[model samples]
Target: MAATLQLNTTKWSLNSNQSDVLIKARHSIIAYISGSLNKFKGSIDMQNNEVEDACIEFNLDVKNQESTLKNIDSPLYINDYLDSNTFPNITFKSTSFQKISSNINFLKGNLTVNNITKTVELDAQLINITIQNGTKTAIFEISGLIKRNDFDLVANAYNHTNGISLGQDITLTANLEFVI
Candidate 1:
C-alpha cells in the first residue's frame, strides 16, 4: 500500500538544530558539554495526521555522540558511561500523541538508554504541510528536557574528578521532515 500522507511520499529523515547534553557541578567544574551528535537515524510510522495509534521508534548511535572537548564514540563502550557494547543503541518508542492547544501537541513515550527505560514527554508544533515538486512533506519542531542521571548516565567526572556531574540535563530540539 502507498503511504497515506498529505503529500507524495518519498524519503524522510530526522534532523536536529540544537541539542545541549551537559553535565556540571556546584563548584562549576564542567564535566562535559555536547552540542549534538548529528548521527541519529530513525523513522516515522505515519498513518496520516493521526499519530494516536502509530508506533514511532528511533535508534541513536552511541559511538557518534560528541562533546565539546572530544568525540566519545569509543568511550561509549566503556564501563563508566554509556557502555554501548552492552547497550549498543539509545532508543525511544512513542506511546501516544495528544493535541492540547490549537498549535500544541504532546508526545509521550519511553526512552531506553544504558539498559534504563524512562518516560519522556516532548512538546511539539506542526510547522507546516506543503506540497512541492509533486511531493507532500510535513515539517515539525519538537523540544524536550531529560535528566542524564535518570538514564543512569552517572559519570560525574566533573564533580569528584572521577564523577562527571552534579546532574546532567539534556535539552533537545529536533526538526523532522516527512513525506505523506
Candidate 2:
C-alpha cells in the first residue's frame, strides 16, 4: 500500500532585521536615485511548500525611508515624490500568488501608495529555504516596475524649476525573509 503524505500549512512572519524594501528611479538623463525603506512588516502563508495560493501582506513606512543622497543637499527629495507627510504608509495585499516555474512566482495584489490604490504585479523568486538553529527560514526577492504617475507621484514645482525630471517608471525591489 502506498502512503499519501499530507503537508501542513505554515504561517511565517517577516524578519525585518534581515529584510529590505528598496526603490530606484532615474534622476535626470544620466543618473539614478536609490533609497531604502527602514520600517516595514509583512507575512506569508505557505501551504505544501508552495507559494501558489499563499496569502501575502506588507506594510511599508514611507516616512522612514533612508535616502542614499541625503548628504548631497539635492533639491529633489523623497517627499517630492512620495509625500510621506500626506501618505504615511504604502501597503500591499495580495490577491494571488502563483508559481510559474520551480523557483519563479507571480504575485498580484492591490498596492496603495500616496493614498491611491492600484493593481500591481511583481515577479517573485524563491531564493532559498533553510533550517538553522531549529528554525525554518524562507527568503524571496520580489521586483517590479510601476508608473509614478499612476500613483500620483508626479514632479513638484520645485523639481520642475530645477529641470530635474524623474523617470516615470519606478523600480521596486523587496528582499524579504520569513521565519516560522
Candidate 3:
C-alpha cells in the first residue's frame, strides 16, 4: 500500500521577539514579537520497514503578522524593511525527506521570500505515531534556527533605544500534527 497524506494543515511560527533592536539607550528595552503561519500544508508517510517520502509547504501573510508591542510592529510593518504591500508572503516547500533511522530524518527544501530562494535543512525526529478512531496520526516536534537577514526580514532598526538591538538569527520551534 502507498503512504497516506496525513496532514491537513501544519503550523510554523515566526517569533519577532527573538529579534533584537539595537538602539542607543541606557538599557535595552526590546521584547519578543510573534506571528503565525496562516498558510501551510504537509504530509507524513510511514509504511514497510522505512518511512516513505514527505513534503511540507509554508506561506507568510504580512498583514497577519503581529507582535507584543504595537508601537514596534505597526511602523515596521509599513516600512521598506518588510515591504509587505509589495511582497505579501514568505514561503517554503520541502523537496524530500532522508530518514536516518527509525527516529531521525533530514528535511531538505527551498525557502523563498522577496524573490530570493535559499536551501534549508531541518533535523526532524518522530516523537510518536498513534491510531485513534480508525485513523492513524503522527506528531513531530521540530526546532531549528534560520537567519532573518538571509531573507531580508530586517526592519524598523534603531540607532539607540535602551539596551536593545534589532538582531538577526530567528529560532523556529514547532509541534506538528498529521493524520491518515
Candidate 4:
C-alpha cells in the first residue's frame, strides 16, 4: 500500500520564493504579454502519494503583479481591468483531482476573480517528490486557459472591435511547491 503523507500547517508552507503564478495574454492584436503575481498564499494536502483526495487553496494579490511592460502594469490595477482597489485578490480552491499517469493529475477547481466565480481545470504534473531535512516536498507544474470575458474582465471588450485590444483568452501557468 502507498504511504499516506498528509500536509498540515505545521508541516507545510507555501514557498513563495520557489513558486510563481503567471498569466499570459495577447496584446494589441499583434503581441503577447505576460505577468506574474508577486504575492500569494497557498495550502495543500496530499494523500497516499496521490491527489485523489488532496485539497489545494491559493489566494493571489492582484495589485502586486509585475509585467514586462511597466506602463501596462498600472492599468491592470485600475478599474479598467483587474480593479485591484475593489477586488484585491483572486482565489482558487480545488474540488477534486484525478490521476492520469504516475506523474500527472487533472485538477478541477473554482477560480474567483473580481467576485465572479468560475470553474477551471488544470493539467498538473508532479515534477518531483522528495524528503529532506525532515520535510517532504512536492513540486508541480500546472497550466490552464480561460476566457477573460467569462470572468467579466472586459476592459478591452469594446476595443476588440477596433482590432487593438487584448485577447479574450488568457493562459495561466504556475510552478507550485508544497512542503510538509
User: Candidates' lDDT values, in order?
Assistant: 0.54, 0.70, 0.52, 0.64
**Which digits, one per residue and each the tens of the lDDT, describe model 2 over residues 1-180?**
999998887788878667766666666322122224444466777776665445566677655546332413355555666666899777877788878877778988899989999999999887888999999999877889878888988743344536666677777777888899
Supply the global lDDT for candidate 2: 0.70
| TM-score of every model versus the real structure | 0.57, 0.75, 0.60, 0.65
Q: Who is ahead in lDDT, 1 or 2?
A: 2
Q: Of the pair 1 and 4, which is ahead by lDDT?
A: 4
List residue ranges in candidate 2 displaced over 4 A: 7-9, 28-42, 45-50, 65-75, 155-158
Model 3 scores worst on lDDT over the 10 consecutive residues at 17-26
Best by lDDT: 2
Candidate 4 has an lDDT of 0.64
Summarize candidate 4's per-residue lDDT along 1-180 as a digit string, tens digits: 999976533334566556766665656321112224444456555555654444566677655546332333323323334544678777888888778776777889999888899999988876777999987888876778877888888746544334445667767777778787
The list of candidate 4 runs beyond 4 A from truth reads: 1-13, 28-53, 64-81, 130-136, 155-164
| lDDT digits (tens) for residues 1-180 of candidate 3 | 999886434422222222121111112222222323245567666564235656666565544545232333222222234445667665668888888887788888887756678888877766666678985666664445566577776532554323234445545444555565
lDDT (C-alpha) at residue 75 in model 3: 27
Superior candidate under TM-score, 1 versus 4: 4
Q: Pick the candidate with the highest TM-score.
A: 2
The order by descending lDDT is 2, 4, 1, 3
